[model samples]
Target chain A: MKSVEDINEKIREGSVCVVTAEEMKEIVKELGAEKAAEEVDVVTTGTFGAMCSTGVFLNFGHSDPPIRMQRVWLNDVEAYTGIAAVDAYLGATQQSEKAEDYGGAHVIEELLKGEEVELKAISKGTDCYPAKEVRTVITLEDLNFAEMVNPRNAYQRYNAATNSSDRLLRTYMGTLLPNFGNVTFAGCGEISPLNNDPEFRTIGIGTKILLCGGKGYIVGHGTQHCPGYATLMVKGSLKSMDPEFLRAAYMPGYGVTMFVGIGIPIPVLDSKMAEKLAVRDEEIKTKILDFGVQRRDRPVVREVTYAELKSGRIEINGEEVRVSPLSSVYMARKIMEELKRRIERGEFLLTFPVERLTPGKALKPMKTAIKLVKSVMSEAIVISPETSVEIAAKIMIEKGVNHLPVVENGKLVGIVTSWDVAKAVAMGKTGKVGEIMTKRVIVTYPEEAVELAAKKMEENDISALPVVDKSMRVLGIVTSEDLSKLLAR
Target chain B: MFLRLRFDSKAVRKPVISAVTLKTSALINIIKAEVGPRRGELIVEVDDSIAEKVEKAFEELGVEVLRLKEKVERNERCVHCGACISICPVEAIVLQDGRVEFLDKCVLCGNCVKVCPVKALKLPTT
Candidate 1:
């Protein structure tokens, strides 16, 4: 029984590594793009976050003061966080498996090592829905894990010729989503149906424990259970209301949050956990309300004696079992299948302590919240505004450059469009160069991430930003006109 | 299945009419799954007034009478689970010694088969 810390350390020490977009490109460059594409197989789309924010919850207990605590709440946390990450990692890894020399288990082993993967966000949200983005970097490290657990890869050699329409990677991605999501729903069940991504395995049938002996049983869909729900959240403004009135009427806990990996299923832990959590929650809340905020002492795992374990009857395979240290999104699926088998056989008697399971032991680092912002432009070409009217004409004539940025003192000061240059010449101002320059500059600092750049562009009603450094020196430029091109294969 | 009744002729004012239909062997197999096999004779006894009503309704429906019978004995037994008693549009079933006795007023529509708990009640095959 390794602790979470211990297990993480071990994984960190493993030889597997993830690959980034540049590394993948290098592989493609070495082995022709067509050949490189042939070696890898895609698994599935990774998980994604919908709403990733948290709010403070106040728990009223029997203690001295009402406990004001920070409770993480979201509609579907596990699917969005750890599971999503694994999904992304696995999907990318599967694509990497197509590498000619790398095949099957070997690829999976490599992915576990970790790779530098660049996930660029494609889009953001509208008023009705949360943000949505498509990440498009498949690395060698991701390929390793994908090939390892993939059922098809597990059964057949990478080079082995097989006839099956289900061999396509896109189909594989579809299969993984439902099954993984189902585990998040049903607690546990068989994965073979999902692994095969059978046409009929459309619904998630929960564990059916027969009180009688026969296989004749009822099937329950875990999706039917609503994990946690709240009244619609109000986000706009509450400043006008009186403080006491606001406090009484409002439950501050009603905010949208992105759920991390799957949470621990409510049933697996020791009985005292809920009680302990309840007590700790109350203590933390009291301390917070008393002095505005207080930190809780980290909890220690309580050891159970052999006698206590036997008496408690929390056993798996006839031996006492405790909460698993950390389960990957894939591992979580395996556990669910085991649970379903035990339940159907009437072997599972102990209750699950929690309703959710997290893929990793700890929450994802907050920095992961910063996803790569995508550019809107598909094509771009750089041109200088200072070029002579005739030179600009010649460049535009030959290269089809649509926009040109004006540079002064190594800083982008303005932009002159080909359209502008043509118009300036028609209006008798082209050759002067300075007269045609548009001085209203839209620029983004290199230190600022893609998301912030996008926001600033949106606010200013601009299409492109000249990338600048700390000293306002121009590095490169991004424009809506050329963004799509920059991101294209 | 059969029905045997001992009744005064005057009690059945109009000519007492009885009808029956033949069913397939598959029907029997289905019934057997739900209910036990037939045993003693099935007996039906009906009052004259209800018997006249059943005859009129069946006649108006343009259904041909299978067989007009005064009495017939067949090996069939019904554990009066009250299925037939509750199902009959008319009060036609009388229970005695855990057996069901239907009156002549039975329309013989085979509805009891549809409602039988164990499918103990069924239409007889020719």
Candidate 2:
């Protein structure tokens, strides 16, 4: 296997052969991985997407009298100053208190673009560094140090988000249309940095790369990074960044986040590296999670490949749903081309990581003991109005369900219970369930609180209530027995 | 040409859109449609050469057909994050070089106007 030093020597000698991950895919497909490995030196992969974990550490060098700044505000957006006297960390997603559509991400982009930022700080006033308050304007050049240390960046892959519920859902994934009308997904899959090096084979601690149009390094594995699902903790000089590759984005209903452009060049040290570079959109898989469930563990509606996702439309439960690419494919491709140019021009060189990356622990969701009606309900058994009482009795016995919602077409028309069927059998009567079903049916919605649903059942002296949607279509049945089993736990 | 057919409360029940395709050779490509019991709207594309004929047919059926672009405005305030693109039903919105481009195929569905984070897309009330 070739060493990184050998690749660097070739880069310096202006003899390196570099291509983008997109081009390398064609190369590997045309002339197998073994042959491609001997020909290509590096495969540059890139992505530009909203990475909320991005932040900047700014050292507004000690104010005239050296006020030990306790709290900091940049463009009216709060920055954490708990670490030091004049240094603060401005997170990308923090919104401005005084301005609309402005955030820490905007402040960072404005600073890099050579624009001035209004900085204000208040201190509790320590004895030695004793100016209690400070207000000043600063540019990128004015800072003693400004380093962007994003705790998480370059996700290997992320699930495409959709909403299965009837109501529109506004999420960090973007606005998901109700009833699976559209799909919104993150970064470019096959050409993304972490996707090409899924195992962190070439990407590790100290590996040099592009960060928002500047040189950056992967410091370690990102928070919540798992083995197959890799993310990076990266850092780079904020002053060296370009605004073109770093942008401020605001998702409606979801606050501000930064669009970070990252390009990592994977040195083809072996045939294994070549094979990884050949990973196609068809081979990359991402879940279609229903964002309608506002929880850490949203339900996975389906597993689809980037091939299907990028095709502009995908089938969700037999309906063709249009997919939107939230991450800029155009920008991602531009970054890949830019990185390739730098490598070919010998301006950039590959570096071996001093330490290998280790997966961070899996995420632990916030502990919420509260439950909804849906959490305690079972799938409702429904029969049409024309069903005979004899068959309804057989269904109740075979399915072990006491209550059934009588449906006409797709709508909930009436309710029938095991008692009605049994009573019909005892009376020696044979007729359709329509004659026995209750016309005025009580119903509960999916999002209704379990306590409220239970109270409705108790007050009405009913064992179960049919769950329906806005259109009165039967969703399921919530039974008092189900609540008893759940609350007993 | 793309045309939007709006059916008021009284016209909502009539099988007008289906009637257009059933009676004519001009097959409609319905890009976006939202029909309810009270009111309904449809955005469809037919042969540009026969666009006038189709619009006339819809009007004859008492449907309000609009060739509207001024109804919604994409102002200078847009951050071009393309969040509006995700919710746009007719694939009318696109992002090019960090700018949101509204294509001619827009049905004026107002979904993008509702979803713009910076309030860049706006629909002027009649």
Highest DockQ against the true fold, candidate: 2
* lDDT tens digits by residue: candidate 1, A166-284: 12111111111111110001111111112111111111122111111111111221111221211011121111111111100000112211111111111212222212211111111
Q: What is the interface RMSD of each candidate, in Å?
A: 27.9, 3.3
> What is the overall TM-score of model 1 with all chains considered together?
0.23
By summed lDDT, the worst window of 10 consecutive residues in model 2 chain A runs over: A359-368
Q: Where is model 1 more than 4 Å wrong at Cα?
A: A1-363, A366-386, A485-489, B1-126
Every model's TM-score: 0.23, 0.75
In terms of lDDT, model 2 sits at 0.85
Candidate 1: docking tier = incorrect
| Candidate 1 chain A least-lDDT 10 residues | A153-162
lDDT of 1 by residue, B1-126 (tens): 222322233323322233321211111111111111322112333344444444344344343223224211222222222323433433455444324566755545465554332234555555
In terms of lDDT, which candidate is strongest? 2
> Looking at model 2, how many pairs of residues clash?
0
